[model samples]
Structures are given as structure tokens and as C-alpha cells.
Target: MQRKLSKATTLLFAVTAGQASAALFEVDPGPYDPAIGSFAAWYQDTHGRTLDLCLSKNVSSRVAGAPGAPSYMCSLLPEPGVFDDAEPLVFPTNFPPEAFWFTADAAIADAASGIDLTFGAAIEAAFAVEEPAEGDQISFARIRIRVDVPTIGTYTVTHPYGVEVFDVTAAEFGADGGRAINMTRDIGIGAPKTYNGALGGDIGPFLRSVNGPYAEVNPATGQLDRFIGDPNLDEPVTGSPFDTNYVRIQGPGGIDLRTNLFAISGKLSEVVRPTPVIVQRATYSRSSGEAGLSTQQDVFAMAPPPPATAQYLDSAAATVPMTEANATGNWYGQSSANATPPATVEVSADNSVAIPNSTPTTLSAPLVDVVSIQRAEYSLNSGQLTLVASSSDETEPPALTATASSGAAIGTLGGDGATKTLVTGISPTPPAKVTVTSASGGSDTEEVVLLP
Candidate 1:
């Protein structure tokens, strides 16, 4: 099948027209997106100063695998920007900063075109646990980093999540610390989240008004003071979600032993996102003569299956349809070609199609088709017929060569002289009757089917 352009197209987009132009590079995500989700960077200071620069949301799980053991599109690393190795770009702070500890899990982009443009320093910031303490408050380190590239093309690695690369200008440190200055700051996190596919969790940096922000040193606070709500301090709180950019103070609670001397700035930074999964459709069929005892209610959530027959029969296979009733088994369920609604099954034993674990099953279905192939037209040139293969790839034209037929003059076909190879020119001299082959390996005998 012809391959089509995907998310990787932009990778090779803006390249100069020359031999020195940019080249496309493919990198495997390496089992990421699901396993280790995103990370939230926070600060908890010694003097009870607390702040959540990096917001955390109560995320929910969406993927529902086979019924036996629920699985999701597991990702090994947390995020490319955090989990992956990062070079510490120094903070040009005027004060002497002290302390830093970094965190990561893998999926990050380290090098581009084999070039090690990574930075690393020390991480000294607020954390959950406490370390050595100072007198009043603890200080942590922060670094602002960004990248600079001469030509325009998709960059493999970016400090931010969504953006592929940090577009910078020649001017460095123009108020906004970008490529020339090497810094990143603003970061947006995912809003709605899931909880292992069961329930959805809510996370935000706003201090819960009941106490403080959405989080506190002790309580799971979800609070924040509104600026526009009560312009006079008496009106009701607005429905707008809490914003955290204004609450950038170093977290309190014996966080850093060093002074307030850090902040990582960069051109761009991405929100740590999780891999998304879908719940598949599955059916349990017992059309093999006899039916099982219990119905859907019999579904043994934790009970061991009936030794021999149970395990082998994955009653949980997803998305299988009841098209046709084969002499052997039922064919795919018949349905209107236009109707795409998922086919349904019953939990009733009367139909004898229910399993003990009546919880229900569905087959893994695609939200959309990625690629499809269809038979196109059949064209005959001179004495040869050709079948065209049409599929996902439609960019460049498709061309297939043909073989000539025997006893037919090479000139039999006027224009298509350039295609055929073996059976060329009037079947290698008339009297020599030969048959040509088609792509499908089918044969076509020339006009003289009669006795040559």
C-alpha cells in the first residue's frame, strides 16, 4: 500500500531547495504516553510559603482493554520534556542561587541530528518531603532554557510539550528570554483528567477558598481568591476556573534551605499529557450446540474460569460482528451499508448467548479508519491488461510495468511501447506464439487462439 503523510509531515516542511536542505528523522516514542503520565513541579518553602507554578489536574483514564485485566495505552516515560534528559541552561540571576534536584523518566528528546544540545545544572526547589533546613526559608534552583536553529524545519526535540521546536531570533534577552537568551516560562496543563478509567479527577492550582488554594500543606485544598468576582469584596464568586500564574511565590514549609534565587525561563514548554485509549466492543457467543448455565449475572468478576474451556475461549474478544450465519458459524451481522452504529448483543440466556459475567463486552473499535484500499479501474493497452492498486497514498502517481504477449508485433500497441519487457514486439516474431502474464499472475493469450 502506498504510504501517506502523517503527523511527521511538518518534520520535513520548511527546508531550503538544495543538497544541504534539512533531512527527516524518525524517533520511536519507546513505550511512552500511558505508563508514566505527566509530572507537576511545585514549591514548598520553609517559612510556610507554598506555590504551584506547575498545575496538577485530577485526570481520568479513558482506555478500557480486555475485561480480564484492564489495560491502557501504557507509556513508559512521563513526558518528553521532563522525563527525558535535559541540559541545565544557567539562569543569569544576579544573586547567588543554591540547590537543585532534577526529575525525569525517559521519553525526552536529548539530541537533534546527532547533536547533543542538552543543558543541565542543579535543581533546588519545593518538594513534598523535607531535607536539611536553614534559618528562615529554604531556596531551590531553577533554570530557563531554549534552543536556536539557523534553518527552518521541524525540530525533533522541544523543551515544551505541544511545540516541536523553539523558534528564536538573533536578538538575545529582549525582555522576553527566547533563543538568544535561552529561556522558557509559560506552561499549560491538561484540564479534565481521569482516574484509572473508573472515575474522573479534578486538579488545579487554585487555593480552595475554604482554606487556601486547591492544595495546602496538609489538606487537599482547592481554593483561590478572585480578582474580578467582588470588585467591592461583597459579590458572589464567579464561575471562572482559578488561574495560577499570579501565585508564583516559592512554596512555604521548610522547602529550600537556600534563599529565593531561582526560576527556569524558556522559549516554550509543553504540558505533560497522557496517552488516550478507547473502550472496545466485544461479544460472547455460545452457538456451539449447548449453552452455558448462567446469564450475564453469572459473570465471575474474581472467580477462576471453568478450567479447560474458559481460558481458551476469550468471551471478551472485542468488536466481532454477527454478519452471516455460516454453515460452520454465524457470519458477520448483516446491516445496512450506510448504518455505522455498533451492532448490539443480548444478555439473555433464552437466546443462549449470555455469559456468567454478564457485565458485557465489546470489541476494540476504531474511532476512524486510518487507511483503506479499494479496487480501481482495469485498463488494456494493445494486448496487455493492467490492474491499478489504489490505497491511502495518493500523492505521486502509481505506475506498473507490463509484459508483452506472444505472436503480437511489438508495434501492436502504438504508444505503450515503453512499458512491457519480455513479450516485446509482435510476440518475438509472429510464428512464435507466446502468452503474456498479468500482475495477478493470470494469463492472456493473443488473438490467434485458433491454431497458429
Candidate 2:
């Protein structure tokens, strides 16, 4: 199924002026490049991390062809980290569990076997941990060079993932029909060469020690030899040039493929979130029962100021627990029973309070007349206060309205005309005031203090 696509192979990226005809090709050069995306700027933007390898050596070689044919050259640079063993290769553990290692291998297969080797530097070989084929791991890590042909805008070399080359035999190379691979080319300095399958010309085998017995060669003849029941060293080939191996391409006219430039990045940990604040029912209970028929009773409740200190206006008038009293006509009034439950009281705990951090403060008592302030609620968000003015005798309850001091605004009155709401922007520092007025012209003023 693996066939070297023709140079006319369409590029994955659109062809720009003086750019390579193809964008990505396949090749199995060796272990997954530890420094993946080292030269890819786009890689950094997408993966959020950079490759681990560093560039060691970069050199340019010019190939002169027959007069007027075409002048071209490419750079011979090793893949990042190929040369420096001091820095061990480390794969990212952050990758998805199912992520597999991918690489590109270089080779020229049987030219006469209907397989094409014309795609100058496209991917030729690869191995994946999850690859279905159970092939030898030895041939998986082969070192190939980079071939950057500037003129035609093509760099024939290995990339991470792509289609695999067709399988064939070493017999094609005059050896036993062993494992087949797509051979990578070299950036020759002393001597120059062109690509011809094992049939007639030099079919470049990976020069670096990483690839052993895989299209292995006779160093003496530089010709590819077959696997003679011998396996490559358990480890990659060692030493200097080995350390600097890079991805390379072999164009027919001797053009070089330049490695593209790019970067890598990653996150350390997750962010922590904050907790929410909750307002609970007011802390209060009925203290005394209303006197039978027409007498008032003392209302008592603990105002549990929030730890953060708060300014609140509380009243027990409209909220006093009420009961039906027996008479010529049953009348609704404050409960005679002392154990009646009280309604919730709201408190506004504005942060701008004048009291010292450790000081505990309480609001002033309301102006008491015929009607008494029964229950009060304060809204923390709006700094609004609602007070209930109540009378012991429901039939004669006073009609009440509220007035505010400086920086305060009055809201609606209750249906019974005994409850009033006041809004204020005054800081708790100076304390705000509200006066409750009865329809009969009687009035009482109360001081609102915010606690710390």
C-alpha cells in the first residue's frame, strides 16, 4: 500500500510562491523526536508546549549540475537533541493515555515493483506502539538527514504522523528478502549522489547509529545490505556524528531541504476557586406576650451581627406574633402567648464601618409611643431597612410612615400603613437616622449603627 508519491503530489498546504509542492510527507528516521515541534512555530500555538531537543549543527552544501540545468542546495542539520546525549530524551506524560510514538524512516524500495520512489522527500516508514503489525522494534529507530531544496520549495524528510510505505524485501537490494523500508538521503559534503532504488544506484541507508540492521549497510561499500539473521544493537549506535543526526532529503538534481522554524509550551496545574457567602434566618425569639385586649409588651431578640460588622435597623411592630382575641367580635392583635415565633430580621453588613475591628456595636432603640417598633429587616446588598410598627390593639393600630436623615431615601409603606422602608448611602461610620411618624402627628427617631 506504501508507494513514494510523485513530486507532483499535492501539498497539504496551499502552494505559495517558491514553496514546496507538498507540505507533509512520511518517513521513519528513529525514535519519536524527543524534541517534537522544535522548529515548528505553528506547533507551539496548537500543542501549548515546545519540543525538548536543541539544534547542534547546521551547514549548507551546494550541488552544481550540468550547465544551465538548475542550481540548488540544502542544509544538513541534525534533528534537535540528536547530538547531545547529556540531555536525556523525555516524552511528555501529559499526553493522552492512548497517544502513540510516531517517526519517519527513509529508504528507496523495489523500483520495478510498481511502487514509486519519485516523491523526493515524503514520509516512507513509521512505527506506532499501537500499530497493528507486529514488526521488529530494531528497524523502527533509524537516523535520517534533512534535505532542504530551496529552489523547488520542498524539504524531503520525516514528520510525526502520516501513511506508511508499502512492505517489501531486502532481496530487492541483492540480499535476502528481509524487511522493507523507505531510505532517507544524506547531505553529502565530500561526494554528491542521486536517488536510484537498490536495483542500479545508491539507495541511502540511515548513516546514524540509531537505525541498525534496518536497511543496514556495509560501511566498506556504502551499499544497503539485507538483514542476515542479525539484529541491531539493543541500543542506538553511539558516538559524535551519531549525536548530530538530522532529517535529510535526496532530490534527483541534488537540492537540499531546509528545516522549518517553530516553538513549544505547557501548563503546570489547575486554578482554585473561592467559597460563597450565605445569609441565614435572623437570630431572634419572642420575649414577652401582649397584655390582654389593649396593652403592649416588651419584645426581645438577639441581633447576631455578622462577624464582619453590620449596620441594621430592627423593629418588632408589624412582625409581632398575632392571635385572635375573644370579644363581642373576635379581634386580631399581638399574641397573648409569649412563645410565638418571630419573623426573620434582615441586617446590612456594609464593609465601610467606623468601629474599630474588635469593637462590638448595636443600633439605638426605636422611638416608642402608642405603637412600638416590632421587627426590622436590613438588606446587605441595597443598604435598605424595613421596620414594622405595631399596636397591641389591632383595631386601633396607628397609621405610620417613615422619614430619613441625610443621605437616606424612603420607600413604600405596608398595607396596614405601619411598616416603612428606608434606603441609605451614608457610610456606617457616622450612623444614619430614621423617624417613624404616626398619622396622629406623633413621631419617634431611631439611630442606625453598623457594628464591627
Candidate 3:
């Protein structure tokens, strides 16, 4: 017997035909505002730290209320207390250090009039798993553009990806006589509202023209409406594709005048465990007696918990445990002889079977040598012992510990391929022989030469 489908299913298929074809692309916004172009863009972290992403020519001149400057001037100046000026927004702070970040740039300019009339902007954002939910972490990017054109003229935007033309007419200066365009382009999983289920087929990461006053044929009413796009429907809307350039403005300036363009990335899914980061790796030989025995130490920079909730190290020799280092705020693991290369390191936020885990990383064998102790000397008057060491790898020096012949610990010191001086108390006195050991188990013992 043949079965007839419901009208809702049929309508869903019809709406799916109008799915958006554009996808978000990644671009480097460069250093916040440089002194070359009329553009300014920034990335604000959850902690309220702002980072400039483009070059700005006349940032000071485009201040609000400034003569000839647009009312919503793009200011490169960071907000006091709200913006972090000392350091840029780093990874793992706002975004998962392991997740991929995508960015895009769009600008229009007409410098033929002697003065630089540029409307350039960029976006740097990312989307990742928030755990317990898929694709829920949407780190939306703020798309800020500097509009410095005091006179009405046509401005054409061209970039490596696409180009668009905008005619700066009087109408663009809204009722308030100000030029401003802000809109958000988000669809699929983390959208504010659900569109036609399955029918819309993820038509997002693109500017939505329907949110603004742009004119488009309304699918519901079949008549031209200012709010033409329906976030609820998969119908065609007059907006810029999310990945290429900003949506084509249907109004006076062809700019979306509703909301700021905050691009969304990543797909809807449970948060995946963040990949383990191996910051440094080194191999060290055991003391002279233990020939052919070497130990490999791997220092890893652990990602913050939501994604890297738990971390572990697996190898042939033994499953090593990892712990966070208080000194460097990183995770450390070590394996000695008999352990095979290409060890697997994994992390997970959820130990249960419900959530997706982080991708396991294959750690290769260490190719560089760990630092080794070289010399030892004692100062009789000061009761001070000096230990010297050298490292083949200067970038990641091994930590060292010094001990006396009586097995009493003298002192611990960090290695920088330099001499380490430790003061021995009069009670312990100075031992005739001193032994230095590296974090990787490399050791060197030398007779202490007494000094005046």
C-alpha cells in the first residue's frame, strides 16, 4: 500500500531547496589598528580583553562627534578597564586552545578624492564544543568598520575572496543622520531561534537581510516586505554569504542596518576533548653505570577544563600519570627505557560514553638531549656550593636538583645553561662530593673543590 506524506513534510522539502550555499572562511585580521588604512576591528574575550585586528589610518579623527566622522565611528582606542591593553587576547582564555579559529575580512574604499574614504573591517571568531552540548560554544566576533567618508560617493570593496559596491546616499544616514550597520549572521545549531526544521538545512554563517529594512520578496505573504528574510524559513533572504564577504545591503548603503555581524562557526555536537599540547620533549642518558638506558620527558601545556577535563598518557613501557606543574602551569609526563615511540596522549571532559572525547595525540620520540650537570665546587668561608650545568637545547632547559654525599638535599635550582649557587648551612656542612640530578634522571657527581 502506498502512503501519502503530510503537508508539513512536503513544505519542508520545498524550503530546503533555498538553502544557503555560502560557508564561513578564515582570514588573518593582522595587527589591530595600524597607521595605514581606514579600518579597525577587534576581538573581545569573555574576560573583556579586546585585541585590535587591523590597521587604522585616522582612528583619532573618527571619534564620535568628531567633524566629518560618522556618528558610529570605529574607534581603535581600547575601553578603559574593559579592554586589556597590555597583552593580546590569547588562546585557551576565550577560546579552546585546541579548537580551530576562523576569520574573514571585508572592506570598501574610494581614495581617489585625495582623502582616504575607506570602509574596511574584519572578523575573528571561533565555535567549539561547550561540553554537555554540541556546537554550543559560539565565540561570536565583532565586525567593526571605520566609516570616514564625509561626502557622498560610491565605495567599492575588494578583497582576495570577493568584492561588493555600495552607493553612499543620503538615505544611508538613517533618521538620526548617522551611518551604522550592525547585524548578526548565525544559523543551524546555536541560532537564537529555530528556523524551519530540516527544511532550512543550516542556512546561516551568512548575514540575514530580513532582520533589517532591506526589501525582499516575502515567502509567507508573497509580497515585498522590509523584513523579508525569515529565520524560521529556509527561503532566500537578501544578506551576504557568511564565508565570503558581508551580505549585500539592500538599502541606501547596501549594508545590513539591523544587528552587528557576529559570525558563528563549528557544528552542533557534544564538546570534544581538547588535543594534548606537547610543548617540549627531551631525552637524557642515565648515569655512566646505566649504559643504553635513557629517559624521555614530555612537557605538555594543558588546555583549560571544559574540553580537557581529564588528561592521561599511554605508552608501551607503562601508562604514565600526568599532573599540572605549579611553576609553569603545564602538564608533565615522563617515560624511561623500554617505552616505545609514538605514545598516545588523550583527554576527556566526560568519562562516560555519552559525550565525544578529545582526539588522541601521538607523541614521538624525543630527539634533543636534556641538560646535564658539569661541575661542582664549594666555598668554605661562605658555606656555599656552586653547581654548573649545560644543555644542548637552550629553549627548554631541564630543571636540576643538588644533593650532598650524605643523601641530604642541598637545594633545587632551575637550569639555564648557567652556574647555580646554593648556600649550605653550617650544621649540614659541605660534603666532599656533590651530585646533581636533572628532572629527566640525568645525573652527574663531582668532588667538591674547597675554596678560601
Candidate number of the best TM-score: 3
RMSD each, Å? 23.8, 31.8, 24.8
Model 3 misses residue 75 by how many Å? Answer: 12
Error of 2 at 307 (Å): 56
What TM-score, computed on C-alpha atoms, does each candidate reach?
0.19, 0.17, 0.23
Q: Tens digits of per-residue lDDT for model 3 on 316-365?
A: 43455556432112345555543232233332222222123434444444
lDDT digits (tens) for residues 1-452 of candidate 1: 01122222122212121110000001112222211121122222111112222222111132233443322111111233333212222221111122221211111122232222332222223212222122112222222333333332233332211112333332432432223324322111112111111011111111112111121121123532111111111111111112111111111132111111111211001222211111222222111124422111011111111110111112233222232121111122221122111222221111112122222222222221111111111222343332222211122112222333433332222222122323232322233233433222123333323222
Q: Model 3 RMSD to the real structure?
A: 24.8
Candidate 2 lDDT over residue span 1-452, tens digit each = 12243332222211111211111111222334334311111100010111111121111122233443321111111133332212332223212111111122232333333222322221112123422122311111112222212123222433221222222323332342222233443211111011011111111111212332223333334654322111112223211111222322333345333222111111111111111112222222222236434333332222111223333333443343312121101112222222122222323332113112222323233323344555444555555565655433343444576656663545434655334433434333333666666653345567654433
* Deviation (Å) of 95 in candidate 2: 99
Model 3 misses residue 7 by how many Å? 73
Give the Cα-based TM-score of candidate 2 against the true structure. 0.17
Preferred candidate (TM-score higher): 1 or 3: 3
User: Could you arrange the candidates by TM-score from highest to lowest?
Assistant: 3, 1, 2
Off by over 4 Å in 3: 1-276, 288-298, 306-317, 325-329, 338-367, 372-452
Q: Give the Å shift of residue 305 in candidate 2.
A: 44
Better of 2 and 3 by TM-score: 3
Please give the TM-score that candidate 1 achieves against the real structure.
Answer: 0.19
